[model samples]
Target: MNPRLPEFQTATATDEQKTILNEILSGPRGNLNGPFLGWIFSPQLAQHAQRLGAFCRYQTGLPLRLSELAILVTAARWRAQAEWHIHYPIAMQAGLPADIAEAIRVGAEPTFAEQDEALIYAFATELYETKRVSDATYQQAVGRFGHTVVVNLVGLLGYYALVAMTLNVFDMRADGQNSLPFAE
Candidate 1:
């Protein structure tokens, strides 16, 4: 699918949009892509989303590997091509097992080497596939990570899901990529 909005450019932006865009550009992401391109149409929403995304991707209580795993689950579930293209490598760099990542990419169950990875996989997949996690899964996560981390995990899931939805709705895609790994 084609992009619904044009790519953001400083010269064409209003002062407020430029300010927000510059702020995003200077941050860890370094450049805007994916849903941000479409979100820039609403500067306030873009700013707010970027901030939330930063927290989910960087500051969440879960480790980077776990967070990236959850993000991959969301991306695959949504068949979000751009999101998968962006986060798959990041997840690998963060130490998510290649086989596990590949399994998720292909819509198969992954064998996790770490218990934390397994729990996160179960939690994320249950949340996405069933729309709710079972009591056992909830308690297990809470027992291991505590309430705050669990809350952050949920927040991460919700935030990325929003991003995936935005990208899908806009039909945003990575340049030069032919198709996403998973089939609908």
Candidate 2:
């Protein structure tokens, strides 16, 4: 699928856009792609979102496995193919079981070996489906991960939701993968 908007043209970038672009390029992302392609049209939003994303993706207290699980849940909830395609490998590398990921892709209940994975999956899915978590789930997450990580988890979910929206709206799919994780 083609993107709804043209990719950002560095040659025609405004000073503000250029600065933000440079920051993004120099940051952990190291490239202009994904939602960055859509966000460059609004440099201010791009700047703030990218900074927040940096925190959510890298600086969050949640361990890589937990963080990736939450991200995959968000991608599945939103049916954001690009988000799924990009993070699936990262999640696998972090030791998230392929069976679990495959379950999420197909909207089945994943049987998790680790208690933490089960907890995260429950928290994320509850929050997305019901718009709020039950007290048991909330207490479990806070007890397991602490207040700071719980907060970061929420922020991470919100940020990824924004990414999913951007990708879905602009049709910014991952390159080199043709099969859709979700049926259209």
Candidate 3:
């Protein structure tokens, strides 16, 4: 499937877009792909999303393993091929076992050895499935991760959900590959 939005061109970009593009290129991300390609159409949105994304992905109090798990949960829920394809290796490298990821991909309940993994999976899955977390889940999250981390976890999941939507709507695939990670 062709992407709904074509790649942005620096040569034809307005001054505002050029500045945003330059920041994205020079920033930690160092590339204009994924949602950035769609966001570049509106430079202000691109700028805010870029900064928020950096904070959510890097500055969050949640550990990388947990955050990546949240992202994968969002990807699986959204059936976002690009997000899963990009982060699967990162999640594995961060110590998430292959079986857990495979379970998520196949829409099965994962058996998590670590309590933290189980907690995050439950938190994310419940939120996505129910649109509101039960009081018990919220308290469990706060007790385990504290208030700050709980907030960050919500923001990170929200951001990745947006990323998943952008990828799905645009039919964006990583590296020009054309295969669905989760069966529809």
Candidate 4:
């Protein structure tokens, strides 16, 4: 069944609102959840908020590939089709191997480099299944990945996990496909 779209009272956008909406559109466009987003005019406040969130994901300085792995695990936890559809490729482009991406997408144990693969999967699974991470898990992550990567990995999981939920709420759709690193 088609998802129920949000029904809201429409009002003419004020100059301030328009400015905020435009800002939101500037970067981190976020997923466009269906045609319904057409209603959200870009505004400065929204843009700034989105930008800040994006910036925070980088606060840890983890390599981009690790960040994407964390995000992929989070996406699977949510079973957010659209979210996975969007990010699977981004993860690959960031250096995630195609086989690993598929394994994660299909919910299998992927062949990954020893510490890197297991660490991300364990963290992601715990977060998804339990909604919280264990201290031992955190310690392992920090021990292997270092402080910065460990923090960023967790943050990235939360960030994309939230993004997946938001996309579901809005019924977001993937824009289009290009060559993703994970493609067969």
- Order of models, best lDDT first: 2, 3, 1, 4
Query: What would the per-residue lDDT of candidate 4 be over residues 1-184, giving only the tens digit for each residue?
Result: 1344444223766776655555545546544332224234434434544654566445657666777777777766666666677667677888889888788877888877747777778888887788888999988888887887666666667666657676566655556633322222
* CA RMSD (A), model 2: 1.1
lDDT of residue 141 for candidate 2: 93
lDDT of 4 at 21: 52
Collision pairs in model 1: none
Stretches of candidate 4 off by over 4 Å are 1-3, 6-12, 28-49, 56-59, 146-149, 177-184
The alpha-carbon RMSD values of the candidates against the true structure, listed in the order shown, are: 1.6, 1.1, 1.3, 5.1
| Model 3 spans with C-alpha error above 4 angstroms | 176-178
Q: Which stretches of candidate 2 lie over 4 Å from their true place?
A: none
Candidate 2 per-residue C-alpha lDDT over 71-181 given as tens digits, one digit per residue, 9 for 90 to 100: 999999999988998899999999999999999988999998999999999999999999999999999999998999899999999999999999999888886768788
Report the number of clashing residue pairs per model. 0, 0, 0, 11
Q: How many steric clashes does model 3 contain? A: 0
Best by TM-score: 2
The best candidate by lDDT is: 2
Which residues of candidate 1, in runs, are more than 4 Å off? 175-179
TM-score of 3: 0.95
- lDDT (CA) per prediction: 0.88, 0.91, 0.89, 0.64
